[model samples]
Target: MNKRKPLDERRAEIVEAGLSVALREGVESVTVRRVAQEAGISLGTVHYCFDDKDAMLRAMGRSIAMRASEPVIAALEAGPDRRALAEATVDALLVGLKEHQEMRLLTFEFAVSGARTPVLREVAQAHLTQSIAMTREYLQRLADVAQVTWASDIDDLARMTALRIDGIELAWMVDQDDAAAREGFAVLARDVFADMRPELPAG
Candidate 1:
């Protein structure tokens, strides 16, 4: 007989299955029954794993936030000058967005759904907070590695960076134009985030 999977692993599988459903159908269609079906598990199993739909959604929110951070983590591995590293980080973000465009679009759908749905607001808010904090950490690490700083307040700058990326990703999702996305990100990295570069050091 097959041994049973642990609760944590089972929960992760259910979460990923739920995301796959969202990626295929719109976020609004992600009912617990639907997710259960997608996961090929019993309704009892799902119920055992999650308190309710809201709990499942909360899991999905965390999953998306974790998915979103991976590109930056990978980009951090490529050590280079501050400018190049910033550009690499931005490019990695765009690449990750492109690679998982469906999931990314679902992220927006979840946000919009949360805004209109009372039960989901906190889940969405938590994801948003986590995303901004992840960006802030990325910015902070870049600054530390490059020995530079943003002229503006780092807190505010992190918020701006997160919003700018959201706007760009949304535009790309609508247009399906990768070229325009790259151009937009290049401008974002070089022009918008130029504040990340400080003034020259005197002799």
Candidate 2:
């Protein structure tokens, strides 16, 4: 007999399966039964993993968002200056977005689906709130690394970060122009994050 996976592991597996199904077949096809088929597990297994379709989707949305940020978060470092830090961070971010284009597109689909699908509405709302909160934390971490503080409210910066990222991902997906995306990131580093420039120690 094969050993059963742990609960958390199983849930993660199901989340991946559901994402595959959604990305492959569209969000409407992401029923528990369909995800179970994709995962080669029984429908009951999916139920055990999630109380219902909404719950499963919530898990999937959260998983996708977490993965989307991992690369950029890993790239954050103390640079010679604030601009360098911003460039490094957003460059890693652009790489991640291009690398996982499908995943990034799926988030856009979910946002639209949330408008039409009642069950997905909460998932969409939750994701926006989650993204903003997570961005807030990331901004704080970046500031800590740079030994600086934002001249503006961190919450506002977090909201701006979340919206700008969403815009960048969508624009990149449409254009598939790496050069333009990099150019935009450069601009963001200069215009947006310049607030942290004050932290450079006086010579």
Candidate 3:
């Protein structure tokens, strides 16, 4: 008899299959049997990894959010000046969105699931909170590094910026017009950052 794949590997495969199904046919189509068929595993195997559809959906959401944030985090750590940091943030978002179109679809499906399922809702809220916190930290770090002060409310601005990013991502997923999406995001970022320039000393 062949040895079974490790539990972690099996779980990862199931999640990937679930994401594929959700992206292609929508979340309602991602039943345990469907995922098992997609992953070439038994339904029991899918159950062994996830408690139920809700659990699978939550796992999928977490995975997509983490994968999408990677490039943004990397760009922030690239030691760029403030303008570069701002542009990198926008560019990273656009590239990540374009590269992970399927993941974005899955994310939207999970969000809709959250509306009716408490567990999924909690998971979504937690993920959003974590994302916003990370955004706030990155913005604060950029301000400090560039010796820029924000005359307006920093926390409020950060939250607004993050929400704008989330909106742009969802819009881009549907529109798939990369040039238009990038231009819109660039304009938004430029306007936000430009408003703070007077707070910094002359370069």
Best by TM-score: 2
What ranges in model 2 sit over 4 Å off? 78-80, 197-203
**lDDT score at residue 147, model 2, on the 0-100 scale:** 74
Candidate 1 segments exceeding 4 Å error:
191-193, 197-203
RMSD, one per candidate, in order: 2.7, 2.1, 3.7
- lDDT minimum window of 10 residues, candidate 1: 194-203
List per-prediction Cα lDDT, in the order shown.
Answer: 0.81, 0.82, 0.76
Task: State every prediction's TM-score relative to the real structure.
Answer: 0.85, 0.90, 0.74
Better of 1 and 2 by TM-score: 2
Evaluation by TM-score, superior candidate among 2 and 3 = 2
- Candidate 1 per-residue lDDT, tens place, 1-203, comes to 86789999999999999998888787888888999999999999999999998789878877886786788777766654655676787789788887777777777887898899887787778777877887788888877777777888888888888888889999999998888888887877775446856753433
Model 3: CA > 4 A from native? 116-158, 187-199
Expressed as tens digits, the lDDT of each residue in 27-118 for candidate 3 is: 77878899999998899999999998767766777788778778877776644376777788779878888877777766666667677777
